[model samples]
Target: MVTQRSSRVRLEWGPIGADRIVEPDCLAVVVDVLSFTTALTVAVQVGAEVYPYAWDRQDLGTYAAARDAHHAVGRYEAQRSDSLTSVSLSPRSLAVSSGLKRLVLPSPNGSTISFRLRDSGATVVGVSLRNRAAVAAWLDAALEDDPARVLALVAAGERWDDGSLRPAVEDLWGCGALLAGLRDRGADVLREASPEAHVALAAYDAVADDLEAGLVACDSGQELVRAGFRDDVVDAAQLDVSAVVPVLSGERFVDARRPLGE
Candidate 1:
């Protein structure tokens, strides 16, 4: 659908929208609030570089070894007390670990989307409600430096039982949170936001009072809770808690506390 491109901030629902909107000059912010982006924020906060990898890939060990990074294991595998690997996609697991220099995190949603945009020459940043304000400030500064480039917020939704993309409310809320943060800074950046971004902002406003409760009730949140990951849902709902912004540089995501591309 939205084939015509514009030099403004846009909100894309899932991979399809990402495929349609992402360009060489666009800046892509991947939001996977339920887990991936949240975990990335946590990892980057502790001074770790994260490499986004697709979950379906079997050569992750080789890929991690090539990059001198540690490949993350599944949630169950990472939870074992005797497990040697400290890397995992689970935010709760990563929050407790320290001294990890590099990590290869795999996910079907956010990582897959990040991997798709790797060669597009777009500056991809992993964001969520946790660091929405920081990312918003960073993006606002970026826009001030170069108004010609567009920013696309891609909400990496979950997959359904039939393998169709099921848009998750948590990500929509996360996108809206970032958009709201940008608007709070000044209207100059807000003026560049597309209608879809406004809609997401409106959605966030409707549930801002009880963000954690809302996440706990969402489909993706419920799935995580059923899988014994309610803590992750709670962590993802914390708005503006982190100051770290994970920006994709070279092959891994680094903390962008300083100016981007520096």
Candidate 2:
């Protein structure tokens, strides 16, 4: 059983931290800047509904098939196979592709956190640097309508060599971007923000001048570059480029800009 806290806005890293921070009244904003959230943002912007699932699950095809969605291949597998690359977690690929109505995006960090929050009775929204501003605006609007509700920003950091949560700079930067956006739109929001939130905002302010350069120099970004996914990192670094916010509804992610029923 998770304990509910009284904070208005908080920041936490990875699933373990998120599990402790999330509560019934809390709204979860999951940030996986390296690729998962970025790809989901791009895919939703292109009218594709995404389903998040654990990367370790080998039955993602079954899960997708049950929902009549297509399961995306891993990044490395997609890179090796030209035909599969389009459905992979590459933001550029998903941004340009069409006819994929539903997709299952598997990730160890973002997807796991999202899945854990699915039944926590909280509204889950997938955010990245690409859609952070828009998401912050949407979140502000939501809070304005219900000022009592709490919000928690979870940065899904990459895993280290020992499978521990490695605090990836890209995720920290992404969290900072969202916090900064919220702070810019609503001063009162920051006044109620937790210390972690303030720290993330400070981090974002520090890298505001050259976000791309900061991402390029990050360890996770360097690893992706060496793995030939440098374009993904570049795409993820484009702050506020997307206006669409991917909100998890039911089992899939849909554009929050639309009406609830529509």
TM-score leader: 2
Compose the digit string of candidate 2's lDDT tens values, residues 119-174. Answer: 88889999999998899899988888887888888989999879999988788888
Model 2 ranges with Cα > 4 A deviation: 1-6, 260-262
Cα RMSD, each candidate: 2.2, 1.6
Model 1: per-residue Cα lDDT over 83-171, one tens digit each? 65466778877888877878999898998888878898899999989998999889889988997878888989999989889988888
lDDT of each: 0.85, 0.86
Error (Å) of candidate 1 at residue 190 is: 2.2
Per-candidate TM equals: 0.93, 0.95
Q: Which residue pairs of candidate 2 clash?
A: none
- Prediction 1 global C-alpha lDDT: 0.85
